[model samples]
Target: MVKVTFIEHDGKEHEIEAQEGLTLMEVAVKNGVPGIDADCGGACACATCHVYVDEGFKEATGEASPMEESMLDFASERQDNSRLSCQISVSKKLEGMKVKIPEFQG
Candidate 1:
């Protein structure tokens, strides 16, 4: 399991032991982490699963693809570190990664 943390808008933290081969959105949704709507179900078609990747883990998360970047345009409060959780696969490289959920979905 890859260890990851999801920080809620109000600063609540959920530490998760996520299975590899699953998307970060899957981990959050399965763990019932609030604020992750994931309406597109990992299809990269919506911005509801948006999250801010922690700066320290940026390289591990990698850059968003063009499709994802276009989708993120719809995300509310998008930032430099913004990414769609569904687009981020859980892996050993992402162990100990942290992501912040915005106050609102797209």
Candidate 2:
């Protein structure tokens, strides 16, 4: 399992352990992480699962694909580090991954 930390708008941190091969969005929604509302599952279509990845976990998680990039354009609070959580595949390298949920992700 891998550890995922989600930072909420009110400065709260929610941590959960996810099985390998599960996407970040899967972990969030399955565990009711609140901020990540993955409307399109892992299709990379809806941007509701948006999150800002911390710089420490960026290289391990890697950049979003062009498909994800295109979808991000529709996110509510697009930012320099904005990413669709569904695009992130869980791996040992991402054990301590931390992501910040935008205040207005609906």
Candidate 3:
């Protein structure tokens, strides 16, 4: 299992043990992490699962695809590190990954 930390805009942290091959959004939804609505159910159709990938884990998480980039444009408070969590697949390399949820989703 990979350990991923989901931090809220207000600084609340939720650490979860996520299974490999599942998306980060799935981990958040399964673990009941607040702020990750995942409205499209990991379909990458909505930006409700927007998150800021921690700089330290950026390499592991990689860049978002063109489709995901287009979707992120709909997210509120988008940032350089902003990503649609549904597009991030969990893996052993992401064991210590950290992502911050936005204050609001649009």
Best-performing candidate as measured by lDDT: 1
Task: Please report how far candidate 2 places residue 62 from its true position, in Å.
Answer: 1.4
Predicted structure 3, TM vs. truth:
0.96
Give me the candidate number with maximum TM-score: 1
Q: Go through the candidates in order and give each one's C-alpha lDDT.
A: 0.96, 0.87, 0.92
- Cα lDDT of candidate 3 equals 0.92
Model 2, runs deviating above 4 Å? none
Could you give candidate 3's per-residue lDDT for residues 1-106 as a string of tens digits? 9898999999999999999999999899988999999889988899999999998888888888999999999999999999999999999999888899999986
lDDT of 2 by residue, 1-106 (tens): 8888888888898888989999888899888887787877778878889999888888888888999899988988788888888998989998888899998764
Question: How well does candidate 3 score on lDDT at residue 32?
Answer: 92
For candidate 3, the per-residue lDDT at 6 reads: 96
TM of each candidate vs. truth: 0.98, 0.93, 0.96
| Window of ten residues with lowest summed lDDT in model 1 | 54-63
